[model samples]
Every structure is written in structure tokens, then in C-alpha cells.
Target: MLTKRLVTALLTAVTCTITTAAAVPAQAAASTAIPVPSTGEHLMPAGGVFEAGTAWKLDVRNAPLHANSAGMVKTVADQTAALYGGVAAFNAYQYSTSFYTVPADQPRVDVQWDNCQGKNYTPPGLLGPEGQFTQVPIPADAVPAKGTDSQLTVYSPSTDQLWEFWVTKKTADGSWSACWGGRIDGVSQSDGFFLDGFGASASGLSLAGGTIGIEDVRSGVIDHALALHMSAPGTWQEFSYPAQRSDGFDTSVNRVPEGTRLRLDPSVDVDALKMHPIAKMVAKAAQKYGFIVTDKAGCTAVVAESPQAEIAATGVDPWKQLMGSTPSYSIMKNFPWGQLQALPRDYAKRTVAPATPSTDPGTSPTAPTAVSTRYVSDTTFRTVRNGWGPVEKDRSNGESAAGDGRGLKIAGVSYAKGLGVHASSEVIVPVEGAKTFSAQVGVDGEVGTNGSVVFQVWNGATKLADSGTLRGGQAAKTLTADVTGASEIRLVVTDSGNGSAKDHADWANAKLLTPVATTTTAPTITAPTTTAPTAVSTRYVSDTTFRTVRNGWGPVEKDRSNGESAAGDGRGLKIAGVSYAKGLGVHASSEVIVPVEGAKTFSAQVGVDGEVGTNGSVVFQVWNGATKLADSGTLRGGQAAKTLTADVTGASEIRLVVTDSGNGRTADHADWADAKLLG
Candidate 1:
């Protein structure tokens, strides 16, 4: 019987294999630019690793083979069968390399030398003139490759530098350390080797140069040479040109040397083989750029970027989606190992022509549309899961099927557009390039102050914003999140610690703000002017029912502070211990439109109400027909009120608005104290 540890290892290995072969989005393959999940940056330039004419990037189909090509191929096949139970396979998650790309702004930290492996070679100096250990821009969430080797690689396109580490691990002090590693400068211009004889691999080859990238497989094309690890390599210390050093221990004379390129026979038709899609892709690449013996490992295998780190950073598993039901171990089982030919050491060194540079910028070719506002009610969601009735659009969640719901209302306030869902519900929306997602959320009034639920927004596994527990009939809370670079957005509603009873939730006026390209144009400046009131007449805004109101939470209140749940349950408007007898009380994201009635000015003292203490933050603005106005920057509860005065001369109407200060509207009860108009 297999031990528990062994069974777990086997299961993990199988899972890694399946994930490694999974497919990527079709758009990812069509676009040469592949995003790094860790930093949302492009993996590398369009050419895919190494300089144009470098050996790793060379097309070796027509290259000459060694005189003992047949003998070398047989040796490799025999060694592979002996080590891997008669078939070669791809090393995916375990004993594999994982690479990451960081942007210019990534934080830099020093990597200490742990010397855990006790290797003999001297570690290379840092990118700067510093000693062996130096600062590298490794993401805080960076994960080393699985297995004992723990190989990790990082590239910074902004600096054109590459860093590789072995036995990488985090220290007790929350810093990083590695057993051995090397740094390469001018990576785009140098040969694909660690010149200082220091690297994660025994052969001193740059992992970034030959490792198969996810995009390469997604595109169905491997343009560069693939990295091959052999359990038996020629001579303990002997290596070929392009390989600066070697740790090969096999002394057999017929063993393949490190850096020896091997290619699939060009005469064979790879497309006709009974092979997995991933295997076919590997074969095509082998027939083109071939494979370079770069390292010695437990088994003879090809190396691809481990999907573990990418999956950790992003909840989506690209490999599982890419390979479907194809088992990873069987990917290369049908490969034509017998027909492989070993090329001469350092073959085509001076003959292979340099590849032409790509004109692409390594980004999506199609430009996104201009930035615009879109409502969630107008868009189709990917999936919807609800605890009770089906998710309803533009209405409150009722007990049964679609269209059985009523109007969406919270705290006696109605919404023209929104999503109605029951507790323990999830609505997933695909928003690849959206800039921001915003929504007003609360328990639907249909629950009538009964249910308690929490609203949350998520981008993959990362939670963007969350609303605290809210009861039915309470003023709605506003949620806004920066969703740039996210592939999808999840709107989730869950019961607040209790059992799901009447937990009908409403996401009112939910919308997305997407970015678009803008052309440069000359700026237009207008002169500022002030209009004086011709007559003195004042009227309080709270006394008028003729005004139109839109509140984030509950209904706009008269002469009081916005309270929790039900309407007409508010207290007197007060801020920082100061009380106002007459004022308009509203929630954050509230808007009030009143007829100007020849009023030349509008004045109000705005602040987050003291009733909720310091729990709320909001910004107050007064608009005069889209003209000159006054704005009270960001105000928090328990703070002094900010006095606002706006010139409304020649304006048909004036608008008073309160918005959450970039934070979720948890307790955003705002007051327009002493709000009045003068003519």
C-alpha cells in the first residue's frame, strides 16, 4: 500500500500535470502580450526569450547532426525509460521552474544567502556592484516553485535585468533568502547563459531563455528552443559551448553532453501523431528550435513554467482549462522518441540567421472603447447562484421564478435599476478591461426590516470591497472598487451570521466605469465670474416636498439625520456636538434636485452626522446647472461641518449631492445642515 505522503505526492503530481496542459483564453494566444498574474505586467517582449540570433531562439530543423546522433538518441531513450518507468513526461509543478515579471514600481528587497544546499560554486554578485546577496524586486506574494529544488526566476523589463534563485524561501523576519542564485544584466542583449557560472540549474543556463511560457502553449507555437533535463548527462565537469558550467555526474562516454541540441525528425508529420494537444505543440517546437540539455534532474523531461505560482496569484487554473481531460503523464507517451536526432555540440552557431524584430508592442492589438458608464442591469452576467428565488434584474427578489419579483426598494426608497438576489447568492460578471465597479447595496425593503445580510465584491480570489451587516429597510451602502486588469467581477451576498430567512438583497444602480483611449487636444479655459443676488429672500430646503430625491440608503429625511432601516426614524441633525433644528438628512451617494425659483445662491453646512460617530466619510458637492459650484472635500463623522456656498445665478435648478469618500458606505449618514436658497 502507498504511504499517505506518497499518495498525496502522487495526487499532487497528477493535478499539476493536468493543470500544466490546460488551455488559455483564445484572446491570450492571439495577443503576443501575456499578463503576469502576480503583477499584472506583460511576461516579456514579443520575441519570447533570448536575443534574436542566440542559439536558444535559432531554428534548428535544417541544422547538421552529430556523427553519433543515433547512438545519443538511444542512450537518452534508455535512460528515460529506466528513470521514468519506460516513458518520458513533462515536469510541470514539481522540480520545475516558475518565472515572474514585475513592473517598474515593484518594491525591492534584499535576498540573503542561506547556503542551505552547500554547493561548491560561488554565487554571482547582485545586479549592482554589491556582494552575492542584493535587492531584487520580488513580489510580496511570490511563491517559489514546488519540490526540493524550489527554483524561482524574476524578470524586470523596466531594468532589462533577470534574477534566478535556488532553494528560495522566506525568512522569519518576513524577508527573502536563497541557497544559491545569479543575476543577469542586459538580458535582452546577452547570450542565454549565466556567464558567472552561477545559476539555479546545474548547467548554468538561464531559465528565462528556454523554459516554455504559458503563452507559447496557448498560442500553439513554441518559437524558441525548449529546456530538457536529463537524469544522465555526459562527464561530471564537461559541457558544450553556451553552457558556462556543468554539474553532470554521469561518466559514460555515450551520455549526451549538456547544451547538446536534440530535434524531432523533420520528415515525420507531427500533426498526424496520436498525441495530446500539448504533446503536439512540443513536437512541433522540437522540430523547429529543438531542445537544449540545460539541467540534470530525477527524470528525463521537458521543462515548462510551473502553474502553481500563477494559480496562487490568480484563482483561475489555466492548465486545467487548456488540457481539458487529457492526463499530463500521457501527454508525451505517444511522442516519437525513437526518431529524435542529436545535433552536433554548438551546431549552427554561425549559420543561423537572426530573427527579425517584431513590430508589436507586446499588448492587445485591439484598442478598448472610450471610457463610459454601464449599468449592471443592461449587461449579461456569466453565472448566477442564489439561495432562494432566481436573481432578478431591476426588481426585488421575490419567492419564485424570474419576473415574479417586485420593484427594488430599500428603506422606502425605490431604485430604477439594480439586481435583486437572495442571501448566499453570487453573480459573476466578465469585465476583462473594466476600470471600476460601483454599486449601492442593502437588504430589500420587501424583507421589511427582517433579514440581515452582507454584500461583497471580488476580483477572482481577492476581495475588493465588503459591506458590513445590513438589515432590511436600512439606508443602502455604496460599494466601489478598482477592478482594473481583472478578468471578472463577483457580486456576492451572504446571511449575516444567522440563518437565511428573508434575506433579499438589492444591488441598486450597479455600474462599471471602463477606460478608453483619449486623443490629445488643446485645453479650453473659461473665465470665472460671480453673480450677486438681486433680492434677499431665504427658504429652507427641508420644507419643500416639491424636490426630487435619490438617496444611497434610506429616503431623504426632513429636519433630521438619516437613521438606520425604516423611514421617519431619524434623530435631529447634529455634527461635532452641534445641533441643527432645520436641515435635510440623507445618506452618502444621495442627490437632491430643487427648482432654483430665481435663487441666485445655495448655501449649506455639510458633514457626516455624529449619530454614527466616526464610522462614515463623505464628500459634499453643490451643482448649479453644471456650472460653477462649491465642494466640501472629504468629511468624516464627528468632524466639524464644512460650510458650502454655490452661485446659482441664471440656473433652472440646483443639485445637492453627497458621495462616499472612496470607501464603502457603511455608516455614511450625511446632513445638509441649514440648507437654504437665497435670491
Candidate 2:
């Protein structure tokens, strides 16, 4: 679905920001200038089939459509003579097309699209990653509501899916009237989505947002050149793209047939020309990586990047000054059309074929096996099962809602939580066997409330919690309930006073955390409470004796003995970072087995390495399998030694475990010096 240049976005790297633009070029000689090849993953020139930045495709679209001093093709002149009898047809009217934009504040929609049956040719395969689209919405303000021009582009970070629409018409019922479309997998370099040797209007790989974007202009530099279009000289029905012939069009002769490639003769120096700055940019691009034919448009015209994004990228308005009166069109009208040459119809450059990778075009990225907890969005009711109403539009007061897992935010009142104002929604708890229910509540929307709102959690008739009389200004109170054994949970919000008055509430970042269950079976045998008769005050064991501790540090670490072997105090055991029982992020653990008899207490000193900003912490605890006996609070990377002791009245197996306070193994270097089991 992601057609690079077909719809929106600029022609620059996806993440580059704007900087002072460079001046017009007197670039090094063509042979000396840094070559910017089109064959790389930067999808451009419609016929290309690469992903963003990997270097996969090298077909007719990216490779020099036809080698200049190397390859040959059926010249545009030869074909024109066989059809319209020559230059008359070439000089026939041709004009560039303009794109309109929708303001950024419009509501985005999950497009409902259908094929323009019988009108546009249907290829054997589908376009784009093969997934049944449900939440597939158009990118914010993807198209101008009134712009009759149908080409469109859409991307959903939530699903990592991008869609391209062509010859489109949006019906009032929220369905698409499209002549044709294609979809591509964003991650996989090559996918099952089909491609025709004869490229379509949006045939260029970079139709959707790719390397070159309007953002590049804002940065004052066009990293790449533009992709333009031309007509096949004759009405010849033999189409080069997915579909060569369609209903209502005359099939007469072959002219600038679909998929034809053209480039400015390398001999013509763009740097030597004196046209508008914009026109010069376009010409130089043609000389190097020329544009390919995508669609039949208002003559031999080149479409620029998304107009909306072009303006927004700058955060200023230089559109008119940069584009000029006719958007550089008047200037291009005089470009060297005669110097252009076309690439062969079906071109491929491979001497030895390699085994192609297997692909599954129809599957959604394997959905993470549903864990116990889930964040049920306030929009869709599919997961709620009961008590959700149609989405409402309330912009003014609701707390601005955060985008979903995908970085997408809609306009209007975002935090207006409810099924049509004072409404309710129910979601199954995260942990199926969880013994607790937890969530955050806030009257976050615009606070037009002298009126109040009540948040209640219920499992059938048994009420768990009631956040009473909450107003917008006093929101974000946390609520907890022991909802043990309940099959499902329901969260209800009711108006405390008069019918709901601007009670846009919020349920933010709620999670149902479940710890790994450990074996609680008491030990069969017990060790002495204190060291054997000759305990000799104390004999210590390194944490490495009981369990595997951190091998070293950093992912690249390999030498285990390199780190501090003992704590700074030099009395007890030393180990790597601390981590939870299972693992937090990195793997870290410390434990020791020692014979003891009536050992009264266990104490030690712990902290991360003495580095500032190391982001490490440790939790030293004495445990008996799943049960925790003593904790050393939380020690930071460089906090002063804090003494901790746990009474081991009738304990046999005394084990120590250091857990990472936050992320695993960043600054986790712990020591249990000055530690012993006092008898």
C-alpha cells in the first residue's frame, strides 16, 4: 500500500531536520560528482521495488532505465512516427498537475477502499503487505476534501502499514472510489505485493513517504531529484505497467507507453543552464537519475512532493517564492525533451540468479500472543464486548489524548472518554488469573464542571471502587481493587451531578503486572543454623557459588574476572548487576549456599559502579525460592553503603539475590562486603 511518490510526504530522508539550504549548484563534472544511485533501498522513480534503506531492488525502475553509452531502446522518435506520424504528437498539449491539501486538524479515517472494477486493469497479484485492514486510517489530512485529483497515500505506524490509492474518489459513506491501488511491506525488502514491468502512475517504489520528502526543502536541500511522467506516443493497448489498456481509452499506437524511462542527455550540463533555481534543480536530477513514467497526466509533467508536507516541513511559507507563479512548470516547458531516452520494455540485470526469499503476503505481523493485560483503546469496541457507544466528536475540553501504540493523534477533544458523553465500556482484565484490578482515572477533558464525575469499578453487582465527585482539575487519582476470581471487569463513569457536562475523563497507561510464579515447596533437608562447631566466626562464599551471576558488563563484555572481584569494604561477596527473579531487562543474579547454625542476621553493602549517570540499582534480598525474607531497600549506582540485616531465626538455606532496580545491567556492579551470618 505504500506507494512512494503517489500521494504525500517529501523526498528527503525520513528523519532529517531542516538546516540552511545550499546555494545553486555548479556541481563537479558528471564523472566527478558523487554518484547518487537509484538502485538502493530509497524507493524512488515509480518502477523501483526497494524498501527504505537496504539496497534490494535493481530493476528497470532504479538501474539506468537504459544504459546511456551501454544499453539501447526503441527510441520515442521511432514509435512516434509509427503512430501520430512524428513531432506533431510530441508537441501536442502537455501540462503539469497541482495537488491540494487538507488542513492538519481534520479527523483521520480508516479508509474503506474498493477496486474500480472493469475500469482499471486488475493484475494477478495484490499490492502492499497482505493484511486485512481494520484500523487502517489515512495519515492525518492525507487528502484535500475537495481536491478531485484521486491519487492518495496513507501510513499507520500502529500497524506499520502504508497504502497508496490511485484515480481515487471518496464517497460520502466513507468508502474509496479508486481506479487501482498497491500495498507493500515496510520491513521486508521484497514482498508478495505485485509489480508490473510496465509501471503504473504510482509505480515508483517511493510513491508514499520515502527518502525525499517536502522536509528536504525545509532543510533547504533536495537530497534526491523528482520523478516525472510522459505519455506512450500511440494509443497502442500494449501496456507496460500492471495494466496497459482500460475501458473508454482508444488503443491505437505505441507512443510513450507506460513504464517508459527517460533521462536528460548527460552531455547537457544543468549547472551551465540559467533558468529558475527550481527548474535547474529538476533538470540536474533528470541528467543523473531521471524520472520514469507513472501515469498519463496533463502532458510530460513532473509531480512534486506532497504540497501539504512541503509547507508544514518549513514551519514557514516559502512555497510561492520557491515554486514561482506556475510552480516551475513554465520553466520546465523548455527543458530538453529531445535529449531524453527510454529504457527497454522489460529490463533486468542479473548474470547469476539467486534463491529468492520466501514470503507470506497475507498475514498480519504475528500478533504477540495475547498476554494477560491489554490496553483497550477508547475507540474500538471489539475488545470491550459490552457497553460502548459510537465514537463522538468533542474537541474543546477533553485532555489531549496520547497517540496509540502507533504514534498517531487525532484532532478534537481527545480525552473525551465515554460512549456518547456519560457512557461506559468494559474490558477483560490483563491477567486471566490475576487477583487484583488496577487503573488510573482522571476527568482530563476540558473542565466545564461544577458538575462532577464518578469512576466505579464493578465485577457484576459487587462494587470494587468508587472515585467520587471527580472534576477535570482534580483528576489522575489511582484506583485499586482486589478483583480476585472475577471472570471479567467493568469500568463505569457516571455523572455525579447534572447530566454529563464536559466530563471528558482519561484512563492512562494502565497495566496489570504479573510476576513469575516460583516454587514454594519447602526444602526437604535443612543446613545448620550456624557454621559447624568450628564456625570460626565466619567463613564466606562468593555469590558465584550458588547461582550464575553477571558474566561481565555491556553486551560486548566477555571476560568475567575483569570487573571488581570484591566490594570496596572487602568483607563479603561481589557480583555483577542485580535483576529480578526471572529477569528485568538484562540477566543478573547473586546467591550463595553455606552451612549455618542459628545464624541471627545477614548484612551487606551494595550499589552500582561509582559512575555518575550510570542508571543502575540493586535490590539485595534473602530468599527461600519464591518467598522473600529480607530486602536491602534499593541501592543506586553510587549511594553510600546502607547496612541491611534480616533475622534468620530458623533458616537453613540462606540465599542472596540482587535485582536490577530499573533496566537490567547498565550500571549494575554490586558487592556484599562486610556481610556474614552472625550466630
Candidate 3:
């Protein structure tokens, strides 16, 4: 639904630069720097991409609404309902923009101008009659936004320059070209707009401006206004202040002009709305910084930083965990649309008062420091398992027994205190109220660049950190996890798909931070004891209904093997060639809670079901509330089932849990064969 002028502008060169202006002082500094995978790659700087006074960075929670705010809200609401089934949505994975930051030392290559669409247009400044090109430092793996737009942005913090391209692509000869694009210099000092009518957006605004980044969502607070695309905008010549031009076509009196800012009613109780966590985040931002009409689209949509590039680089999709089961199109379904208050045209031109400086010293608080530290090697473990001999303290795990190992060494660095264990090992420690756990982990140098392993930390069902596939002699990775309020901590090591030969892994300089205990005297009274229950006839779990069930992949099947995702899709529950007619079939990362009615014992034979052959690996555990009663260490497919028995006396509910063995849950069909309760 974009106008003809906007579509045609993509076929020519567009160069933009910032106008000199007084810079605003930054309000606050970022506490922690975001970790970069490579040395030269950079993300948005501490405060943000541009100066503090830019329209996108201004705090407008108390801004006044226009006289015609109600009419504008009705226009947008009607169009939204017609286009998006009654609600505006965020374009997260597709039809959005992505950006990359590179260092000055990166290779500079010329991006040629392509007239691929056969449109008549003259090349702008910087691209002369000789077809000269400006060199850009783009990373090799950099990818543009997916879909038709193919928009890509590259920024250099060291140079304070930004380049954006539309319909961008790499040609067959490995050279880059775009139908149209622009470059901006002195980005940090700019007013968050393009000059000389050059930019990727139809309104001459920066593509990166107002776009929501992943970190903003993860932190549950967005500090800037959001960029919005609407189907109908005012006439092409009628635009607001931060926009140099507009591509609007609608001449209806109700059409909102380009650059018009609209916000949800500040009086609305956003938290009280039945909205998803992601929607609540957007709603709060809508009430605070509001939404700026930026471009034209088929439906009302908000811009989000495309997640494809990050997913490709890290092999992890953060949205999957952040949004959970909510689909992108419905993330904003519950947002309050009728209450939007449109600001007056040219809202950014209004004079605003500066923030008052704090006078009280107690207003700002520093980050808390560790109260006390204790070496994990000195702590007694509730459970410990090693692939080789015994777990060693203050040493590298030698192939034989305890105290037979050498000094704890990783990547040539020696440590005086730590725990050393082989792969396929687990060590559980009770750290009920610890602050944090930290360690320098790697495949120990004692292995001499031969073995590979992974280190992980878990607090119950939630995994805190993972060091993916560290090889011998590699630089040790610093692993730190927040364990506050966790009853127990699990430190696990697993072979990196290879056999566990020579996989000597070390948790060098491992320690826990905790508040020092305070002692007080108190009187106590003894209580009477009751008789233990006698064993009676067993009741098969398959014959009883579970109080609750949660699975990572498929639904929990009763008395059948976990085959696929559909209900009743599995065969008989089998492990190690033995079939069981009475049991429950489930996927890894599963939990089934059953009411025991004061049962004395819960027993099961747990293993990866034979239906998956040797493709799956898992660990089985039994829990009564937060207390773990039994655990079957890592079991793989084709392995004999391990018999598990737990004392469930006086317990009303018993939890059967299965988790992937330190790896991801893939083909992890697990069986609890002959599971029963006896009293």
C-alpha cells in the first residue's frame, strides 16, 4: 500500500547528513556493556544511537493531546480493525529492519547502485556521472531484513557514521548492490532525521530510529517511542516537523498526518488488562514514549529489530522464550486501541523543560557487592557422579581415584581451589539462599587439546548458564549464574557428542557468594510421631489421571510410547526391548504431578524409550514439592532401564520429571515404565 513516490525512490541514490546542533547531556549511563561475539562488532551505544534530545529519545509521558485527538484515534482504530482483524501487531521476524555495527578496521567495499526495476530517476549526490560509489564496512555474515523490502543498515560507532540500503542484495559476483540507499555522518550529534531528503524511510527519518531492539523487550522496559506504519495518512505535502517529506495519499479529513505521535491514555491501568507479557511491555511504552506514524503499510504495524541475524549468529531464538506460545500476529491483540491520544502536529517542535537534578544523596544506589565467598570444593555435596573415578578437589580429574590428580589447570592457568570431574558427571550442592555461583570452566589443559566437553549450571528446572562445547587448551570461559532463593544448585558436565575419552573438565576457582549467617538462641518443643504406613496393592499410574502435565514436545501419553506431537500418536511404552503395558510416555523436559493420597512409596523404571533407538538421552527424577527424592543419572536410548524408588509417606502429590541430559530436547522420548504408587 506504499505510495508511488516511496516505491520509486528505491531506484536511486540518496545521501544524507546531520545538521550541526547543540548536543543534549545524557541522562544516565548503562550499567553493563553488552557482550559482543567478535572484537570489532558493536551494538547500540550505552544511551542509544543518537543524542538525548532527539524526538525518539524524549520522554513524553506527560505530553498534552491535540484538540482533534479523539477523531484521529477513531480513524486509526477503524483502519486497524479493517486491516489486522481489529488489532495492530508488531513485525518482529519478518517485514522489519535489521542493523549491524562494525569497527573502523573492517574491510571497506563499494556498494554499486542498481536500476533493477527500470525506473526513471537521477542519482543523488556522492554518486556522480561517472558512477562513483561510497565504500562501507559490512561484515561477511551480515544479512538484510527478510521479505520484499530487503532493508539493511550498517553503523560504525568508531566513525559515527551510518549507511542504510533498500532492496539490497549481493549479486552473483559476490558484490553488493541496492536499488536505493543513503549514508549519514555525525549520527551521534544529529536530530534523528535525514537531511537533503535522503533516507530509507518514505518520511526521511532514520530506519533505526524508534525500532525496538531485543534487549529492550528482555529488560521489560522500552525507553523510546515506537515507529508505527499505518494504512492511511494525510496528503503527501502535509507532514510534521521531524519528517522532511511524506509519501501519504489519503486526503480524507480524518487521515492523520505523517509524524503525528499518538499514545495510550496515561490513566489506563495497563497492568490490569488481560494482555500477554509482550503486549504489556508495548502498552506501557505506548503510554510513556508513545508511537510515531513513520510509514505506509497494508496493516497497522510497529517496527522491531529483525531477529534473523541474531538467530543465525547465536543459533538461539530469544523470542521463543520471551513470547512463549503467543504468535507474533496476536502479541498485541489485547492492546487498548480506542483510547489513543494523538499529539498536535509538529509535536517535537514544542519547548520542553529539562529534568531537575536530584539533591538527595540517597536517591542513587550502587550495585550490591558480595557479602561473603566460599570455595565450592570445601562444600559437601548432596550427590556426585563422575564418568571416570572419583571427583577430585583442587586438582584435575585423573583417570583413577580421589586425591590422585594434578593441580586444577585450564588453558595453562593453575587454580588452588576447585572441583574437577569427568564428562557425563553431575554434582548437586545445597545452596538454599546463595547469591551467586561463578567458575572458570573449560576442557582442562591436562587433556592436551584432545577432548571436548560442555559445562552447565542449573537451578532446578531452569538452566542458568551453559558453556557450549569447550575444547582442550581453549581459553577458559567465565561462567556466572544468579542462584538467589534456589534450594539446590546443579553443576553438570557432558561429552560434546564424542565419547568421553580424556574429557577432563575443571571448574577452576569455583565459588558461591552468600550472606554470612547470624546466630540466635531459641527454645524448641518436640512433636509426637505417627506409625509408618504398610505396603499395599500397587496402582498403575496409567490407570489414574494426573493432576497436571507439562511437556517440552508432545502431550504426555498414558500407557504408550511418546511418538510424535499429536495426542494418542504413540505405540507401546518400551525400553531396552522390553514392552510395558502400564506406564506413562513423555518427552524430555516433562513433568506429571499425581495425587498420591498418602502413599508410602513411588516406584518406576525410567529410561529413554527404545522407540527412538539410540537417538535420545535424558535424566529421570522424582520430587516431592521442592525436595528431590530420587534421581536416575543420564540414561541414553538402548540402555537398560534404571529402577527408581522414592519414599512418599504423607505426601499428597508426587512429581515425575524427565529432562534432556544437558543437551537440547531432540528425539528425547522417555518412558516411565511400570510406574506406580503403593501404600
CA lDDT of each prediction against the hidden true structure = 0.69, 0.38, 0.69
Put down candidate 2 lDDT per residue, 450-549, tens digits, no spaces: 3356777778788887765555533234455556677666766676755665555444323343322222367686667887444424433332123334
Where does the lowest 10-residue lDDT sum fall in candidate 1?
1-10
- lDDT, residue 411, model 1: 56
| TM-score, candidate number 1 | 0.47
TM-score of each model, paired residue for residue? 0.47, 0.35, 0.47
For 491-518, candidate 3 gives per-residue lDDT tens digits of 9999999999999999876877664433
Q: At residue 17, what lDDT does model 1 achieve?
A: 34
Name the runs in model 1 displaced over 4 angstroms: 1-47, 119-128, 349-679
TM for candidate 3 is 0.47
Model 3, CA-based lDDT: 0.69
lDDT of 3 at 48: 39
